[model samples]
Target: MKQLRLSGSGGQGVITAAIIFAEAAMNEGKQVVQSQSYGPEARGGASKAEIVISDEKIYHPKIVSPDIVLSLTQKAADKYYKGLDQNNGLLVVDEDLVPNIPDFPNVVKVPVTRIAAEKVGKMLFTNIVALGVLVKLSQLISLESAKKAVEKRVPPHTIEQNMKALQLGYDAV
Candidate 1:
């Protein structure tokens, strides 16, 4: 099984991104389980979503060791990055938001939020871009499957921009 944990602020849409990723994995005939947690503060508080995917049945939903850990905020990054198995796990962080990134063998630092604001024209698209980055980095699901999930989850009018954001993230890696 491949376990992934996505961490960010509450309003960054990490939960939605995790759902989209789980849907993509399901589309590929994988067993998937997703769960999330958020602090009391509604918008800027710490948030995290964990997803487990496998071809076999998922016996346990909780994540013991994540293959990928994505952190979009300094608080989340600081909290989660230290516990990862450095030899095996890949760490991803938003370079703009996380300044003091940890030293890891496998790390991808990208300005996900800035890409959404500048390229996609709204910070709301950060999660979609991050989803694309996760798909690209992990290869857990096909990019085509991820695109289909994006189409399914996002609204009709915003599909174009969302797709653009996904591609930007994919190419960013």
Candidate 2:
């Protein structure tokens, strides 16, 4: 089983990213469980979304030691980075948003928000770009499946820009 935790501020689309990731895993015939938590504030509050994927049945929905953790903020990195698998795990962080990354062997530092703002011309596309990075780094889900999920979840008018953001993110690393 693979456990993934995506953490960031609210309105960064962490929950939506988790849903899309779960959908992509499901598309690959994997059993996926996704859950989320956030503060009362709608935006700029701490938010976390967890996903568990396996070929076998998933009995527990919660994740203890995640195989992959994406931290888009310094607070999230400080809170969740220790929960990663000690021996083998991947830590992905937004370099621009997270200034202090823990000392981890398998850490991937990407300027996701910066890339979204500069390449896609909107910071709102950060999550989609992060999704693309996750897809590329983890290889747990196919790009096609992720794209399909994005198409299904995002607003129709923003599909083109989101796709561009996704592609730019994929190309970044």
Candidate 3:
């Protein structure tokens, strides 16, 4: 199974991103489990989501040590980076939000929020954009399935815009 732990500020849609990932994996006929936790604050507090995808049956429902960890906030980066395995773990962070993050050898810095605001003109869709980049990197599921999953989840009126956000994100990398 492939484990992914994604975390960010409360309003950044970290949980939603994991749900999207799990949905795309499910569309590809894989077994997927998603779980999330968040602080009390609605905007700035920490939020985290864990996703596990496997071809075989999944017995454990939680992420022990994620293979992929995406951290959009500095606190999230600090909290999870130390726990990641050096041999198999990969970390992705938002360069703008986490300026002074520690030097992790396997880390990838992506200006996800800035990219989303500049390319899609919406901070609200930043998480979806980040999810696009992550899904692209993992190749856990096809991009088509991911796009379809986004379209299915978003509201009808906003679906096109969100898909455009995903495309912009996919093309950014």
Candidate 4:
């Protein structure tokens, strides 16, 4: 199974991203389990979404040591970085938000928020952009499946902008 954790502050869309990822994996004929946790605050409190994907049945939904962890803020990085699989895990962080990431073999730092603001004309697209980067880096789901999942999840009016953001992220790395 491939375990993934998407974490950031509330309203960052981490939960939505996890749902999109799980849908995309399911679209690709993979069994997926997604779960999330968040603080009471609606905006700035800690939030995390976990997903497990496999070709076989998923008996447990919780993630013990994630194969991949995407941290969008310094606090999330500090809290969850240690939970990544030490041997072959991939840790992706927003470079602007997390400036002091530990030196690790599979750490990828990308300016996700910057790119969303500069290229997509809004910071709201940051999560979609990050999702694209995750899809590109992990190759766990096809781009078409991810796009379809986005179309299904996002509002009709916002689909174009989100797709553009995803494409920008995919092209970035």
Question: RMSD of candidate 3 to the true fold?
Answer: 1.2
lDDT (10s digit) by residue, model 2, range 1-173: 88999999999999998999999899989999999999999788999999999999999889978989999999999899898777798999999888988988889999999999998999999999999999898889989999999999999999999999888878878
List lDDT for all candidates, in order.
Answer: 0.93, 0.92, 0.87, 0.93
TM-score of each: 0.97, 0.97, 0.95, 0.97
| Model 4 Cα lDDT, one tens digit per residue, 1-173 | 88999999999999999999999999999999999999899799999999999899989779978999999999999889888778898899999999999667789999999999999999999999999999999899998999999999999999999999889889888
Residue 159 in model 3: shift from native, Å?
1.4
Candidate 4 clash total? 0
| Model 1: lowest-lDDT 10 consecutive positions | 80-89
Give stretches of model 1 more than 4 Å off. Answer: none
Tens digits of per-residue lDDT for model 1 on 1-173? 89999999899999999999999999999999999999899888889999999889898787988889999998888888776897888899999999988877878899999999999999999999999899999998999999999999999999999999999999999
Assess the local accuracy of residue 138 in candidate 1 as a C-alpha lDDT between 0 and 100: 92
How large is the C-alpha RMSD of every model relative to the true structure?
Answer: 0.9, 0.9, 1.2, 0.9
Stretches of candidate 3 above 4 Å error?
A: none
